[model samples]
Target: MVTLTPLEAELLAVAGSVPDPELPVLTLQELGVLRAVHVRDTDSVEVELTPTYTGCPAVEAMSTDIERALRDHGVREVTVRTVLIPAWSTDDISAEGRRKLREFGIAPPRAQRTAGPVGITLGPTRTAGQDPEPVRCPNCGSADTELLSRFSSTACKALRRCLDCREPFDHFKEL
Candidate 1:
């Protein structure tokens, strides 16, 4: 049996607490960014991640957060590895992550058939032919919404305003 030191275990726990810089409601794990963690024989910590979006600028901050969290837990050496294969998706977000996003006032992604592109789904009708509907407001659960901007505070989301509640909110746009 492999033995794990208390410090190593503690480091692992703290590493998971680091939240996504863009989506603060979700942790790296909940965002499905954290792929794995291992405590090396040399007492160094290894962290693997798949970026939520390719060319995401938040990755640098995420790596820094991981290193800081591990360092605080007494890990002197830390390696943050980025993996790209089997790309990350909104589907990868956990159920709890969806809940967290809702609580944070950002609508979670809508679920659809897994037939086509990452966010596209082909039904009997072609998705390309229809204009995408407005995403519901997470705060008030209203479908009466309008897109204020294609890009929100982050590139992954869009700025939307609800007609019923008259609230401006961010919606995680379908890719």
Candidate 2:
């Protein structure tokens, strides 16, 4: 791991504390978007951020928020850079972030899907050949759910309903 200077660490804490625009329940750090903080000088700093996916509009808002946060913390020259070389994944989310998402009535994203031996079902549906990973309901803890829409309030989330609780929720889709 790269060692952060004392000021960089402090500034990172401030930048990471900014709440996500789409999911207010999660902070930028919790969302795993705030990557690093580079202290250029006492008053200048640079931040690295990754988006949930390519073409996500939230990156602009996130950058603005990060700049504002750093400014409030006595930073004068703040630059929030968007980095996509290492794509953001749902697995980057912290355990606390997942729990918070569930508490906020949104199902947290699952881990990366494995390539070998996927569960398959013989059915008439388009996905009948191989069953996609089950997305459990955050409200009822039941895997019996159906996708209502490919997109929800946010592009990163999908709309779903729990078969047991009958409550609709947004699932933070895996990247």
Best by lDDT: 2
Give the lDDT of residue 67 in candidate 2. 94
Candidate 1 stretches with Cα past 4 Å from truth are: 1-12, 119-134
Question: Each model's C-alpha lDDT?
Answer: 0.77, 0.84
How does candidate 1 fare on TM-score? 0.78
Model 2 residue runs over 4 Å out of place are 113-133
RMSD of 1: 4.8
lDDT against true structure, model 1: 0.77
Q: After superposition, how far is residue 149 of candidate 1 from its true place, in Å?
A: 3.4
lDDT of 2 by residue, 1-175 (tens): 7998887888888999999998889999899998899988879998999988788998999999999988998999999899986777888899999999999989888776653332434543222223465777889888778778768988889898887888998999777
